[model samples]
Target: MNTRIGTIFAQEFRLARRNLWVGLATGILGLFAVVLGVFGAGQGAALDADALTLTAASLATLSVYLIPLIALLMSYDSFAGEIERGALALTLASPVRRWEIFVGKFAAQSLAVGVAILLAFGAAGAFLALSFGTGSEGIAAWMRLMATAFVLGSVFVGFGLMLSAMAGRTATAAASAVGLWLVLVVIYDLALLGSVMAASDGIFASQVFPWLVVANPADAFRLFNLALIETAPVAGIDGLASTLPFPPTVALAVLGLWLSAVLALGIRRTKRIVP
Candidate 1:
């Protein structure tokens, strides 16, 4: 909230707004929200507690993929693209410290994506609540989803900026961003499954599997959100989540670690940038 940081935030937020990525993301989330609400309601069954839990499960799954992708795209070019266009050099010539620059830009990007998510989810949740009488618990669950989803976006914004700081070109940063998304959001769980299954000793699956899931931010995000739901979307994952050796709090802590480590590294790399 420093003056200089605020200025940078306003400037970057305008850029994101002008680019229409925010609008696009909001539209996508809103579309899915409507689909989920309408189809579930059309079945002639009022969405009681159990039905609402399934809906929560679905939203949690959607957040796992979409939020990270939105955040990464917003941030992957933060430094590298600016540097590529020589704006970073001019910004570097200013009196602001590297940390301030990263914080300002990341804050703006997070705010943009966070607003879009809340708007879409809020509208959808309200519609479902009014239409189906989801009651207090369902409202609270949606609120929780909004909170965790906000943090999840911050986690990936840090990731994208970290990669942005390290890459010399926007192309490299973009590629790295997408690959990181794929690895963490998609491939990590699959690889972990393979490792657990192949472990002849069975100790890995029993003792180490949960920890491994914690190490991946995407999995950690999913675990934290799903731990509260009775019927998780995936059969195998829900079984693990049921007796999830550690509570949802552990996954939340690991996500915090991810954000801190990446932000620190981003600042470190920013200090090294000649621009």
Candidate 2:
């Protein structure tokens, strides 16, 4: 909010506008939105509750992968790349506080990705409205889906920024970001599946499964969006929805905690950057 942070934030957006990766990420999200919209409209199903449910499910499933990956890519270089190229040092030498730099960069990257999500999903919504007479419920559901995707993307941007701050070089930061993505997005689920199978009908599985799913931001995102639907696109987790400790609101709070915790850590770590 201060002049220094505002300047840094504006500078980040200006630089991001020219970044090829930002353009590519935005284009990919837009492409997915258009494709999904066209495919759903082509189904020619009446715009009823079931139709809205189906569309929500489809978008949630797609977003679980797309939003987080794009956010991670956009933020992986936030500090590492700047540090590698000496821009961070130059900026620190000025009157700016390190926290200002970190917060400014984080806010800028989040806004960029958030805007992309809005435009992409907005386009889809427009198409859907044109194809099927707009209804209040349908529009509300789409809006919820869009909001959830943006929050989910912000969580991963925090993750990427944390890695960028901790890693000493861009390559290391990028590698760490990709590895975290694999663990959270892919390997974690596989491991969870194995754990569930091994602990089948045991007290540990019954007591621990819900917490495990909630602990992972990706699973939380999926659960929060798919909570209303009877079936979930993610395998092996649908059955526990009824018994989960918290509701979608809690999952969203957990994601908020993720964004705050990681970004705070990143800011703290970034202050220690030498030269």
Candidate 3:
């Protein structure tokens, strides 16, 4: 990392630490993790397949919504809010490159969210280990889930940053971020369900179903994490994975693409803003 970018990154981290909303949001997520972990411990022994499976499934389901929401809210103000408050002009007046500023902000926000996830899930894992001695298999599964979650959150951070760069007002950025979240997390699946029903046996369903799943980062994240469980049936996910044209590796690649494309576009968009 360039010295300038590193400075900006550190500054953003300090800002995030001081932000009351960021602290509150992380606390809520940590609370959820501890609660789920305790619930899983109560289900059976911590090492039990049923307990691990249930805990993973519940966490994956919750993350599909919560992670993205946190990512979006964390980043929706990155550029737009600064511009709205007239701070962006002053910041850009520095010797730093525009891309450095954008990249630094993105990295800081992503790291903040990742740390929150780790703290939350880590606490749960600790509780399980102390109380019931989590086995290697359970620990491994939890690690994989955590990785998928971090990737999922990065995807949305890129997406929300793009909106923040493009929108002229913080209000516009916030509204677009929330709307995009709803589309990707909720409406996308419902639309896919309708398509499946309409095309039942049509070639569209056969040929296009897998593409649809990978197109949405949330679905891809869900599929990637849920497919990791060796013994549990992950409700709506297993059926799709069985016929998924690509493997979990490909789903992860698609998410990587999403992050790259959105971040690149955001950088370019931010550079174009006159302020």
Return the top candidate by TM-score.
Answer: 1
The per-prediction CA RMSD against the true structure, in angstroms, equals 2.0, 2.4, 2.2
Ranking by TM-score: 1, 3, 2
Listed in order, each prediction's TM-score against the native is: 0.93, 0.91, 0.92
Tell me how far the alpha carbon of residue 237 in candidate 2 is from the true structure, in angstroms, after superposition: 2.9
On TM-score, who's better, 2 or 3? Answer: 3
lDDT by residue (91-143, candidate 2, tens digit) is 98898998988888888888888888888787767776776555666676678
Superposition error at 81 for model 2 (Å):
1.4
Q: Go through the candidates in order and give the clash count of each.
A: 0, 0, 0
The positional error of residue 44 in candidate 2, measured at the CA in angstroms, is 7.5
Encode model 3's per-residue lDDT on 1-275: one tens digit a residue: 99999998998888877885467666887788667767766756444564555576678878899999999998999889899899989988989899998899889988888888887777776666676665677777778888888888888988988899899689999999999999999999888878787885767776788788778899888877766665544556446765666777877888898989988998999889878
Off by over 4 Å in 3: 41-50
Q: Model 1 residue 201 lDDT?
A: 90
Candidate 1 lDDT by residue in tens digits, 74-106: 999999999999999998888998899989988
Model 1 CA deviation exceeding 4 Å by range:
40-51
TM-score between candidate 1 and the true structure? 0.93
Clashing pairs in 2: none
